[model samples]
Target: MSFGLFQREQRSLFGEILDWMLTPLLLLWPLSLALTWFVAQGIASKPFDRALEFNLQALTQFVVGQNGQVSFNLNAQARDLLRADDSDLVYYQVLDSRSQLISGEPDFPPPRDFETPEPGRVLLRDDLVRGDEVRVAYTWLARPDPERLVLMQVAETKGKRSTLAAEIIKGVMVPQFVILPLAVLLVWLALVRGIRPLNELEQRIRARKPDDLSPIEESAIPQEVAPLVSSINDLLARLTASLTTQRRFLADAAHQLKTPLAGLRMQAELAQRETDPVEIRGSLQQIARSSARATHTVNQLLALARAETTGRTLPSARIDLARLVRGVVQESVPRALEHGIDLGFEGPDHMPDDCLMDGNPILLQEMVRNLVDNAINYSGRGGVVTARVLLDPFSGVQILQVEDNGPGIPENEREFVLQPFYRALGTNVDGSGLGLAIVQEIAQQHGATVLMEDAHTDRSQRGLRAAVRFMPKTPRQE
Candidate 1:
């Protein structure tokens, strides 16, 4: 059976590293044993094979060439030498040129027939002698006749070689069992020490207070982990800025709502104290006006907040800029007529191809409505307010412009008017001062730029023109 190194989901870095390190060591252990066994077998065979060759050469002395015929004659000392081993049986055979067995162990196998009969070369092979496996060493001896030769052979059982090979394998394999476990232990300890710094970083983050938006220290972290720390620091900075903006927005909203709330309280108390019907009606009317002003301020605050928050997350689609603007202008016609100002849309009768853009339609509508409403409020009676959507023929950039012939903002104050709750001086308009701010936020969300400039070149006919330039869509967007 085999086991995989990474058999499950890698949930821990430590486990993963340990598995990679130890799996190879464990898997190669068996392979190492196999290779050691092969080497040991070869080591055990060399001396035994040399001894067999020596005995075969010794037996050659007994083969005599008498009158062109071979005969074997062994002395008592040589016979006792062959039979001396108690652990294993030894055997020998002598064959003359006629393929006749001359003496000793008649069942001993012959040499391979295909071998060219050389004069005095010894060869070794494994064969069965009397049904027992034995190692054989044989040689061809030259006779007087050129084509005839005598064969001498000796063989022995494999008891000593088998014992020596077993000893070698035991010596090589016994220590690995103990060393493998120690190696695994050392690798585990090293990985734990290597990842100690990451654990320390985690503890530091966990100890931080809920309101702590400070950056993490990058210099103390490992070089490999420094990029992760830098990204965390960037996120912390953005979160701090967002929190600060929310605090300031809440403070300003409270301050702006105070005056209308105070007026409502004052008018209610005055109406309660008045006895005359006409005076009571006048107090009630003042109270109604204060409530309306408060309502308008609250609505503007909500719109500005929505533009900042929702515009970032809302999915956008291709919208017809001209048609959207025309619809907003048409909706504001009643308000324009009430103010006695001419509210007219100047653009193509139908939506043009270039006028199509990708934007959140609800946010775009709020932006255009704010522009039109702001113009109607600031432009007094008999003033002309023109809202137009035009496509620049050369650049293909779509533009929405609202021009009003009224008391325009001074060149120095143009940038300041785009900020929330900043109303221009000498304007009697009742506004929450958030219209242009909403316009700016919405324009940023849709990748457009807002510019405030004079409607006419002549300084005497000073009128404000607020233009939103929508950047041309890329090929992918198209």
Candidate 2:
């Protein structure tokens, strides 16, 4: 049963601490009581033994032998001197060499024999008498008579011994009992004070405004919490940068959309005011063109916003680069024919089904479509715009290049054209200028690289070659 109890789960930290503190006090309490009893017995027994020895010695002085007859006597003065105080009851016995009682109580046991007894050598032992425990001590008395030797034994009840011992233990341990609680209280107080700074820091953070991106003041914070505060401040800085970019994008988008809308409205008013059939037809044609441009610009703006706002964490799947390129080419074919530009795709004639990359198909299509559109729009009559998708075996990259043969961007203007709302100086075509920027954003999200390089060293091609190189789904090992 005791072993089974030991296998049970014990209590937690606070319970364990309380048990540890109180266990020693409870255990040592009994030990203290026992020690008190022992010391009290020894102290109380000492004087009784001495008086008994003195009485035995005094009675031995009365010993006399008249012609081999033995007689013993004790005086009244000596008997009166042997009485004890009210707190303790003392008993004594005197025995002759033959183990016969010469005086006092005969029921007391005789002292055990020692080979060589020394003067003042006391032998003390405990015994049960009438169901009460008692302490006894005995000493030997030597007389002038050669044959007359006496043994003295003393016995006392344990009441006075227990009382004196209890008092002694209380004197020693009372302060310890008082000091232990005080020590625990001090430890609790210190812990509360030590955690105050952390509470204050939490309150300060909770009190902050939602848009407040300022760095926290670290000087006032405790050293232990400074690292946490620094991390929070770094997060705030990143959030501030993201918010600033978003606000700039919104402002630019509104400004760009306003121009096409105003042009559409003015065309509509002019058409309403015309009366001649030719002039009215001309005004209507202008309105139609303006409205078409406005609609196209709006579509491109929406695509750009989607590309910019889409999270990079959107699920990536294996995309067939050849199929994607062919689809985009088909979509742009009509637009290409309208401008008198020859548009074609060059790759494995059958379209390599395994030319794959890890990317979002919609964003990938948008990237390819914008690049091709930009090429066709820039190419002049009788110009060739080629869309090619190649899986480079050596570099482990999927490369897409859209090249045009008319009015290629100058070396100085190529970088500027990629910026939002930026248009080339000589371009007369209506455009939102967000197409290439959207393409660049999508490419960046996919870990792809875009390069605007010369199609031919002679620069006779006249139009830009925009290429996006994507990392292959399965890269070749070095």
Candidate 3:
């Protein structure tokens, strides 16, 4: 069968290409053999047919019709020469227009599917004479006006023709019979050699340690496989980043937990020593506070871990930021009241929704809560803290902002605020210092950028504005 370029292709590159090349060669081989046989038969018959025609002309010249009867005078020498073929038996016949044999073989069969030939024109065909396959050539000899015609026919067995055809077929087909298998062997060897590099690459990969998430080398890889290697490298790089984040989180968590647990043990010991109810009560309160701080720090570490891990594997859906932020604000209201800080939600309220973002809602809620909690914790008594979800009309950016009119972080220390366990100098806030770090991690997971700046309508006032701008993923409708 012929191969089409657009047919359903196979995964095996070697097999696909070999099929295209080999199928046509095998299909056409038999046709080539048949054509060669036909050519050989034509070559074998040419001289023999001409010799028969010459003998017929000689026999026709001997015919004397002056007595109104045909006479054949083919001498013994001419008959011996005609029958001299060593490889094939020869026969001849001469007949008059009345269908009576004038001389020669009486048992020679006439041609099947016969048509009368023009006078003096020779014709050749195959026939069975005396139950033997033979080739025949004949001519009709006419003697002018009244059309006195004589038929001279010669027949020869097919042994010589069969032998010559066999020779020609052998000459044309023997080399192909030998070369076809050799060609297949060469093609197979070439395929094996060409695919060896890929096998080597697979072996190299299999030989590597399980922990070896490093990139595969590209310099030695073929151009066709380079893209696959590059993609693997990209995945490795992302995995390295994720692994690094986990390691850092675990280390920071251990360090953060140590201080709070130590304080709790010290406070517990002091409470045991105190006999007075008031002193013991104070020690117990300190122990409770330390335990709470440790718990808070542990929870923050876990949140950061989830942010880093889920970013790559999780599927997100459309989250209503306005609704999520509203819940977070309501939960923080008591804490805001206790701090004597005015914590309020700004932007469009629960009626007509705003700030729709594509993200994991659980992670996003934690992010919003962290930002608001950080603001309230630092915004001393009687300070104003505003939480907002704003959308820019021109840029179509969805922004979540937490601003507080409190003692803000200095310009240089702003960068450190996002680092785990890092607090601004001289801050009297009661916190584990993981809020901003958690906020930064979650913002990264959501494809948003965080910015810290002075939150002041006038330069005279000092505070901080923490804004997270969510870039647009789809075109905004007017």
Residue pairs with backbone overlap in model 3 = none
lDDT tens per residue, model 1, 32-114: 99999999989999999998888888778777887887778779857865874766779988877887888877888987878
The candidate maximizing lDDT is 1
Quote each prediction's TM-score: 0.85, 0.63, 0.75
TM-score of 2: 0.63
Candidate 3: list runs displaced more than 4 Å. Answer: 1-142, 145-159, 167-181, 199-238, 269-279, 349-357, 392-395, 419-421
Q: What TM-score should be assigned to candidate 3?
A: 0.75
Cα deviation at 48, candidate 2, in Å, is 17
What order do candidates take by lDDT, descending? 1, 3, 2
Question: Which candidate's TM-score is highest?
Answer: 1
Candidate 1 positional error at 202, Å: 1.4
Q: Please write out the lDDT profile of model 2 over residues 96-203, one tens digit for every residue.
A: 667777677877765555535554466667765545666776665554344555566666666666666667667766876787678767765765577678778879
After superposition, candidate 2 runs with Cα above 4 Å error: 1-192, 199-211, 349-355, 472-475
Candidate 3 per-residue C-alpha lDDT over 377-467 given as tens digits, one digit per residue, 9 for 90 to 100: 8888899999998877666688889999888888898999998888898987777778888889888877898899999867789799999
RMSD of 2: 9.0
User: Which is superior by TM-score, 1 or 3?
Assistant: 1
Alpha carbon lDDT at 365, candidate 2: 91
